[model samples]
Target: MNRSERRACRRLRVAGAGVAALLALSACSSSDSDSSAQLDSPASASAPDKLSGITVFAAASLKETFTTLGEQFEKEHPDTKVTFSFGGSDALAASITGGAPADVFASASPKTMKVVTDGGAAYGAPATFARNELEIATLPDNPDKIASLKDLTKSDLKVVLCDRAAPCGSATEKALDTARLKLTPASYEEDAKTALTKVVLKEADAAVVYKTDVKAAGDKVEGVDFPESAVAISGYPIALLKKSQNTVAAEAFIALVQSPAGQKILSRAGFLKP
Candidate 1:
């Protein structure tokens, strides 16, 4: 009776041990499979690093040109993505000064670039890539017959000009002062492009804006060259930001903008190369 009972108890204990070992191994196998699955998944395998994304804050007038350049830059650097926030140069400068995470800053004027440089937001000395002059833009039909700067002084003409806070506005003021003409615009726009838009939309009879902006408007408006515009020339500046995380990419993009291809794009868009 003692031998049979002892043997049966030992056999039962051995069988229980085997089952426990199998269960442990099965759990380990399940965990390994899960890890393998995770590694093989497309999302985990192709996830991009945060540094691959770059943000640029540029002037509103550069919207078309920079957008084209951004697309080309992304194509050249497949792993990196370029994003932009285009606005008035003053506003863009203000954002960078206020600690916005911008990798690059391309301004429509040196005056605005100085705002960022003064704040120590630029990584290097800004480079002038292009020059622009002010033009009197009107509707395609020129219904109000805005022909020259002096015509802007007409009380009946609804003229639009950039705000005094913006580079275009400041340039306009300088040009007016040079021409000895005083203009009280119907509205002081936030940016050159906005002022141009007002005239293009037929909301205003005329606006003082960049020649590049007038060209950008295509058939929406007709541009009229004025002698006073010679007094004020806006210089476009490009620079890398000090707080940029992707310095390599930022430098590469800056180089691209200075390249011949970039110059062609800018030229075709009506920007005068410096």
Candidate 2:
């Protein structure tokens, strides 16, 4: 009876130990499975980028260079797009202050940018990215032998000037004041591009515009640098709008504009660095 009882007790103990070991293994397996699932969860993975696209309102004088930069930005981002509205800086500022849906604003003058900032449309302080100076765009050649700013005052010559509200026009007026000359334009274009177009199309013999505009026109018009232009230089400022739908993308574009590559593009287009 003693031997059989002892062996039976040992068998019971062995069976119970086996069951405990099996339960322990199952608990370890369950824990490891839970850990693996958590490691692969969406929360643990890297977050996706929030950048998509943005709309930019810029000065007409920046059309060419900004267009080039916009294309480059799209290419680099792949998932992003850049849309631009180029016009008079004052008009653009007015549009922004009027609640236009834009992600960014690049004004030809700090005064225009102030319009946006003062209206609470700007996200932060506008940064000056480049500068521009006045230039006289002639009809391909000096047909009237025009050499200086005063020569544009000839009554026989038809000259165009940007409207007084525009940055280009303001700069032109400053130049004229510096020269102490009083000359009326044949027409007042709303923007520098339009004023330059007048001469490019021969509608006017000459136009007072930004050097960048004259350069962007290529050989369509000849550029004349006057000493008074130095006093009439305008600074180009860029800022993110307060109503921007894509803040991340807008900031990135601003960074690109202030970057070395963007400055190089601006320089190629005859813009002065800030």
Candidate with maximal lDDT: 2
TM-score of 2: 0.82
Model 1 lDDT per residue over 32-83, tens place? 9998996543234322455687788988888999899999999999989999
Q: Which candidate comes out best when scored by TM-score? A: 2
List lDDT for all candidates, in order: 0.87, 0.90
lDDT of 2 by residue, 1-274 (tens): 6999999999999999999999999999999999888544423322226546789999999999999999999999889889999999999998888989998999999999999999988766899999988888999876888899999999999999999999988988888998999998899999999998889889999999998888888889999889999998999999988777777788889999999999999999999989
Question: What's model 2's overall lDDT?
Answer: 0.90
Q: Estimate candidate 1's alpha-carbon lDDT, on a 0 to 1 scale.
A: 0.87
